[model samples]
Target: MIKNIIFDFGDIFINLDKIKFANELQKLGISQNDNTFTPILNEYEMGLISTEDFINYFKEKLQVSSHEIKKAWNCILLDFPIERLKFIKKLAKQNKHRLFLLSNTNDLHISWIQNNWGMDLYNEFKTCFEKFYLSHEIHLRKPNNNIYQFVLTENNLQANETLFIDDTEENTSAAAMLGIHTWNLIPKKEDVVDLFTKNHI
Candidate 1:
């Protein structure tokens, strides 16, 4: 019996366009092969660096304006379907299982979401969770054992009674290693609204 559920924010609840984001970055002379990019991005996502410093680093290195950098950085975020919101709202209202949101996200993206969704809608989505853990705020990111351990330990949740849903296999695999149930959902084809029917949860 799954008593607790952990959900990934991107591609699980909100849509993401990783390829488009990468292409935009490539146009900006940044690529996956750029050795310096990933570490700093990881640091930014882990909250090890301030947003100002992050923007400054890119501004100096890419010789681009802060606005351009922000625009490109946020290109990965697509949209949040209303049905998913309705589904989560209903699930949260039932109070059948403790809910949590764990995502690898940063300040800029979150700011965009807050602005786009408005405080009321964002709060509506946020209130659905018992705890909302953003990687930057928590200083922890996914596909990492520590993050999963922290969530479980902090909530006093048993691994067997918890189910984690993520769009990435790597993240789900890591959770599975900790004895937590997981569903590595495929986006587009698999909508979270069909959670109970599709996953038979």
Candidate 2:
């Protein structure tokens, strides 16, 4: 009796090139070995730091311009298939389940998405959900137990009756630990449009 659905934004709806950011940064002389920036990135994702501060930090540390940093940061985002948007919209219209969107995203990535997808399209996608929670906006990221608990408690949702779909194993596993059902959907090989047939929902 799954009455609630939680979806991850990246890979679940919009496509992402996971390695594109790292590759783009590499082209700008930043490598994986530059681990010091990781904490700042995490802070940025959690909304603990302002976007200007984030850009400035990278600009000072990497000696890069704001434009370069923004470009590299947004390289991971790709396409949003209209078919998937249609599917979610249809699901929302059914009114059979409480729909939620929970994504580990930041301002820059979201900004890029709005610009790429158009604000109207983005708003249409958002209106499909009862609640749209972004990590930066909520100050809570996925794979964190508190974030899952926060969503559950806030919505008064029963974990056993909630289905969470995410592209990351870590996120799915964390949700499962709280008795929620999850599908660690494989991107490219699987599409959210096949949710009913593939997951047998």
**Which candidate tops lDDT?**
1
Residue 59 in candidate 2, Cα distance off native in Å = 0.6
User: Model 1, range 50-147, lDDT digits (tens) per residue?
Assistant: 99999999889989998889889999998999999999999999999999999999999999999988999999999999999999999999999999
Error of 1 at 74 (Å): 0.8
- Give residue 95's lDDT in candidate 1 (0 to 100): 96
Give the alpha carbon lDDT tens digit for every residue of 96-129 in model 2.
9999999999999999999998999999999999
- Point out the worst 10-residue segment of candidate 2 by lDDT: 29-38
Candidate 1, which segments miss by more than 4 Å at Cα? Answer: none
For model 2, name the residue pairs that clash. Answer: none
Instruction: State every prediction's TM-score relative to the real structure.
Output: 0.97, 0.96
Error (Å) of candidate 2 at residue 112 is 1.2
